[model samples]
Target chain A: MSGITRDTLMAFVDGHLDPTGRTEVEAFLAANPEVAAEVALLQRQNDAIRTLYAPAGAEPIPVRLSVDRIAHSGRRRNNRFLTQAAAAVVLVGVGLAGGWLLRGNADTPGIADRLIADAVSAHTVYVLEKRHAVEVGGDEEEHLSSWLSNRLQTNLAMPDLTASGLTFLGGRLLPAPDVPGGKAAQLMYEDANGERLTLYITPRPGIDAPRTELASLGADTALFWSDDMLTCTITAPYSADKLEAIASAVFAQLNPSGDGYEI
Target chain B: MADILHEIEDAVPALRRYARALTRDVDRADDLVQDCLERAISRRRLFRPTGQVRPWLFTILVNLYRNSLRGQRRSGDTIDLSSIPEPAVPPAQPGHLALAELARAIDTLPPEQKEALLLVTLEGLAYKEAADILAIPLGTLMSRLGRARATLKTLTGAPAEPHLRTVK
Candidate 1:
């Protein structure tokens, strides 16, 4: 008989031995009851460990741990960090713009800045309102879409952000002192975590403005994008990439004529 | 890249099981798995297409688990094992190891031994794979497993090693 060392016995118990080696170990065990008993004891120890912890593998995984979700969020976070770095550079420019504001340009804060500030302020006020968060609830989808479209005069579609995990809470009308129509649509959304997002959209500012702008206000981020017809500033406490993702979805539905805003 | 994501997804359940055994807490285990997934997903470029995703993921998880323990130690946080929920299985029959007792005994094992034992026993990983994941030599892995089983036997009050019976 071959010398079946302690490691061999363990290999046997762990089922790591080859077929020939397994047969040899079985024969050895038959000849030696003491070693067989020891093997049985180790086997039971393994079985006990499996019984204690193996069920966790069989349980349903939570949504937050979904691989697709993790992968999506990871990619988004990288983009957001880059955007934040870019936003920092933009902040330096805002500092220059601030210099302009200090020099008697205060009353005429740029339309983009005015719109972002208003979006953030509206978001802060209404997100805390439990009973009256929106003038129209999301349940009235068709009416809400048409009413906001007619009010904004830009064929606005209630962007369905459900795909991005944001629920459309509803829409309301607010005054836009800087836009031609003097009317803006404030649409609110809530995510599964109860955090609120508001989109303040107005007719095109009728003045030359950068096609896109991003601002960080305390814990919130406001992103503004404009085409020839409408301008939208989305304000939320989410990171830039998350807002960017939602913005893409929002633009797809709101425009529907072409691909959503690029970059 | 897409292929790697699918491979990583397939390994999540086993990663979760090992993490659960290591942490003995569902929330903490899931949190560990999440962190592992995020790291693996982000650093996927480093993964070789020819390599197996399971062991790569297990290696990441084991390293993360060790790092977390280090952080906990530095922060002076002690895990209150009693606060963790007990195993859901029924009590063991007579002569079987009392599973709860065995679990506590397993918890008493040094992290290296616990990791090696579970990777082999519960995870049913190949000895070579477990050794690689633990970053230990095969011989060292065997000795750790031996020491772990011996300690568990004594802790759970199992019988002493049997002596050979002489043939007539």
Candidate 2:
């Protein structure tokens, strides 16, 4: 009775103690009326909590909460055929809109549209590549940066994503017909799990657009931000909030001269 | 593969119960559970053969919950308690007062304590499993559980005063 610790009593009440330990607590409680009452109270509280919420488990789970159903439906929705069909529709729509919008401007595509297109294209191209995804591997990051900057005609810095658990995977140069130089820089990063994310950078398109536009295309979310000199698009399968965190880090590194923007 | 999915599906009910108790809202709880399941399914390849899926899923759920909390903190959105649909139960029964008091006390507990306590008491997880889920040492988990129960006893007007005298 004297040696009964509070933890032993608690484990006894919660049914966590082994039989020998529980018997010791039981003997202690038999001699101590107050300890018995406290144990009883704890039991009642546990019972009350179970009574209040355990019915939720007993209730029929809604169809939407079904994991198999959700996974199956999501897989169906993300199927290559359906995705390609959807992408075709989106591309045709974007092409039509881009044509109309370009007809009005005669010189520049909307920066948001261009960035989204560039992101999806980059994601599709490199996600499929096994051996040569990036022009320069992340191991040659210094050369990757200077090369990308020279190609894009802008001062580009490779944002370190180690804090986000994503390591640099290298970068490449792409055609950005919407930009002044008709070129863009794509920096790729892969997490420890090999989930790849890419950042598409182009010289600023000279359009006064919103500082941030978060858009979802298929399974990927694109977070687009424009500073005075460059517009960067971060495309990943993560949620906007996750992308926001990564984008904030990317922005801090990529735009050393500009005031930090909320990613 | 399918067996793992089936096992995960079986745990969904308990996951929902735990999440509902944690969030106090059905929709939010389901969203948390869904996110947990999706992450678990997608990452099953990374799961070790020796690793049990339940604890791994719980870990994912806890992390997702923390992340959501961080987002909510940044957004500064206030929850309108009135918007939460009340169950069809009538006025307080003999035990309702104690349950309500315990609920408020739980809301007041730090997130770490609440997470640890719920994994043990509410979900009935083993001490080791709860510790693993919370990524804490076994002793730390026990201490948190002890503290949580003691605080609940005091807050729910349990017989702690007399018990403290006897124990000391």
Candidate 3:
């Protein structure tokens, strides 16, 4: 009873005291009506607080607050910043390379050249956008894969570029006036240096197009590869070798049948 | 890595609950939770995989809430305590405290005391754990809780008086 203090009374009310401490407090409270009433009021206050707000924990969580989604978006933002410096250097180098490569083939402007132009153009415009870079974010990969596959009329598996230090930012559907289904899917990816790569994919163009072409134009490199079922133009600021490396990883995943361009 | 995320995910409901109590507004509470989750997940590489995620998350939430309050103060936007919506009344039960009055009193408590009291009472955290989350000594935490409770007791005097004997 001599050990009983205001702190002990509060611990008793909050259920934080040990059993012996609790027994001591209980016996002490039995002897003191005023202190007992105070403890009871504190306990009631705790109950009232819980009653007012505990339902929030039981309510359905909004999707924006999902741990996985926040984690995924956070990764994307970090990727954007980490690569920003390296991407700047690479972009300047590729921009110089891209200028000459496109001029030599401009006279005829074949399907391969046209698709590469569209792919490169899309890449240049979107990579600079801080927001609105993609129609759906990469967190919705499953929905994106299925929706894109349906829209393009071909199976489109979002390639795992994490192996290549690339994070998928997501995809948007675009008009492909030069290809069948008149639709194209642009899948954007970002490297750690904040440099962006875009895959401009369309169902194999009905007219004859080159099986493969590598073109470097103004700060962007476009590597075009076509199989019987689909054509993909990969545009990024990376070198021909780097693009080739990513291309194979993308090719294997995009066309798992293993019949496409052998790296 | 996956384990840490799963741990973080498991703590979301409690984080939301604590945030709800702190902000007393649905959208602001969730926005706070989202910001906390993003920060926790982004900086998780710095977090030891072996540490419990709940206290870490509570620490982040508490810091973010404090920073936001400071930002609002610097911007000269005073929080209108009167603007806090009335709490949803639970059905009356014998010995139930007045919910709205208690909420108002809690809103008016000094931030540190309110935080210490809620961590101990509402979240049911162990006293040490609550103290650690607040980054205060156990003695300091106890004092804050005492002050917070005594203030609440005084503020809710009328509703709580029926059962108490007059000290005189």
Candidate 4:
């Protein structure tokens, strides 16, 4: 009580001092005028701060800021992410199925299998529709090539298959995470009967396998071949011989130099 | 569970008051409270059933506010000093005028001092509770409160009466 420190005085002002200590401080304050005045000013400041902003607490709480609403919204967001993840898995499964159908019994397809799977699945979904088949049609081949090449992050030339009784029907970009660039470009072709075929091409660097493989899964036959530069998977319902002939034409046209084209 | 929500609902006004005083911004204060409540509700299973939820919620709110301040600092965003509204000039009452000056002075303090001052003064929290919420030692909390008051005294100007008359 005799030695009233600043901490003790602050404790008194803040109501932290116990009753016995409070009585002691009160006695000290009675004896000390300057200290008591300071404490009073401190208390008033606290009062003023409260008066200025305390009304905010009394105002009605907005729904968006409510605890219940925030929790509910968080739950909804988590549910949506889970749904999207599930859809991705299903899409991958469909892509794998398409690969298996096209390359019936190829020894080992590697990344080409994946591209074929994705391309066939995309073709199956979009080819059935007469309209909305491609974002950029075959009529705009130069634009499609540049746009798809930019998106897929590589140089892509639209392969001419007119000699194989198929005409360019256009190309679409597909997500191909398993591939090197996380993207694939599928160029579609249509014959006189409106029968369709697709070439799934992606930049290939890390893939270590043979250059030629043919497999048939269901309705589609796929011929997968790769050189040092790129890998292409030709997926169609055509027989293996027919697909190989179309693939040779596609290979020569896609790589016009003939240096990268085998057979 | 319903009882807990109801208790939190009852404490919301007080929490908002404390948060607004802590943040000095309406939207930021509410965001802090919302984050605190969501964390509390989700982690209720870990909460001791017998423990009071009020102090826990306050702890969470304070931590979130501190984290946000740290983030803002890293991003190099200027602290918004202008957002704190100036206190209205009260009618000719001596205490009211002093209080208005005090409010502006509080806004000028370092964040730690301001936080300590509000917890003890505005929220009327016990020294121990305030220290616990701030994660500071009791001695540190007392010192901060002491420094805050001293700063306010200087900024708000000396009181009218110079002497303390002994009351019977």
DockQ of every candidate structure: 0.23, 0.25, 0.21, 0.15
lDDT of each: 0.79, 0.73, 0.77, 0.68
Q: Report the Cα lDDT for residue A74, model 1.
A: 28
Best-to-worst ranking by lDDT: 1, 3, 2, 4
Per model, how many backbone clashes are there?
0, 0, 10, 8
Candidate 2, residues A107-224, lDDT tens digits: the string is 4545666566666666666866879989899999889888888887777888998999998889888877777888888888988877889998889887676466556667786767
lDDT of 2 at A213: 59
Looking at model 4, residue A91 earns an lDDT score of 54
Give the fraction of true interface contacts kept by model 1. Answer: 0.55
Which run of 10 residues does model 4 chain B get worst, by summed lDDT? B159-168
**List of clashing residue pairs for candidate 2:** none
User: Per-residue lDDT for A153 in model 4?
Assistant: 74
lDDT of 2 by residue, B46-129 (tens): 233256667777887888888888898899975565565554444265353455556667766667888898887788888889
After best superposition, candidate 2 residue A182: deviation in angstroms?
A: 21
lDDT of 1 by residue, A207-262 (tens): 97756666666577777878888889888988765676677677767676653312
TM-score of chain B of each: 0.91, 0.84, 0.88, 0.82
When only the first chain is scored, the TM-scores of the models are 0.59, 0.60, 0.59, 0.56
How would you encode candidate 4's per-residue C-alpha lDDT over A134-251 as one tens digit per residue? 7779999999999988987777889777877898889888776666777778888889998988888877746674465455545666666677667777778786546655766787
Error of 2 at B55 (Å): 1.2
